[model samples]
Target: MKLINLITPSANLAELSSIASEHDLLLLRQDAVYLVHKAALPFPGKVLALESDVTWRNITLPASIRAISDAEWVTLSANASQNLLWS
Candidate 1:
């Protein structure tokens, strides 16, 4: 899946809500936490949210997002297009 990540203040969610609608996925980040507002996972696949060097247990996200610890499985933004080409 191709995800568009935006690091904006929590107060900006109102203004950035349109961007979330345009992208296939949306990742909102503030401080050291990540919130998954939308996920474009293929059927039968899963979405995982991982944050390195930070404690994300208190972060609130949709139940659809699966939290993970290891970084190896997280998809890199740089390789997203390439991965999608083959998808």
Candidate 2:
């Protein structure tokens, strides 16, 4: 699967958000964490939030999305063949 790692809430992601490929996965952290609720991710794809970032912000996200730790981040990176990072 393609791992979409977003570090910023850039307008550039508008086009990428519509990509609903089954092979896509989305991970948000840093400033991009603000898009947890507002940004649209790929359909039928798993969306993960950085647990540390979420906790630090004290923001609650939708129940549908998973919160992953740094260890899990490495695991996810290991599984994906392609990674697209946006800032």
Number of the predicted model whose TM-score against the real structure is largest = 2
CA lDDT scores, all candidates in order: 0.41, 0.78
- Candidate RMSDs in order: 7.9, 2.2
Give one digit per residue, the lDDT tens place, for model 2 in 1-87: 888888886646647767647668888888777777775554457778899988988879888788999999998889888877866
Residue pairs in candidate 1 whose N, alpha carbon or C atoms collide under 3 angstroms:
none
Task: In angstroms, give how far residue 44 of model 1 lies from its true place.
Answer: 19
**Which candidate has the highest lDDT of all?**
2
lDDT of 1 by residue, 43-65 (tens): 22334455441244466656776
TM-score of predicted structure 1: 0.39
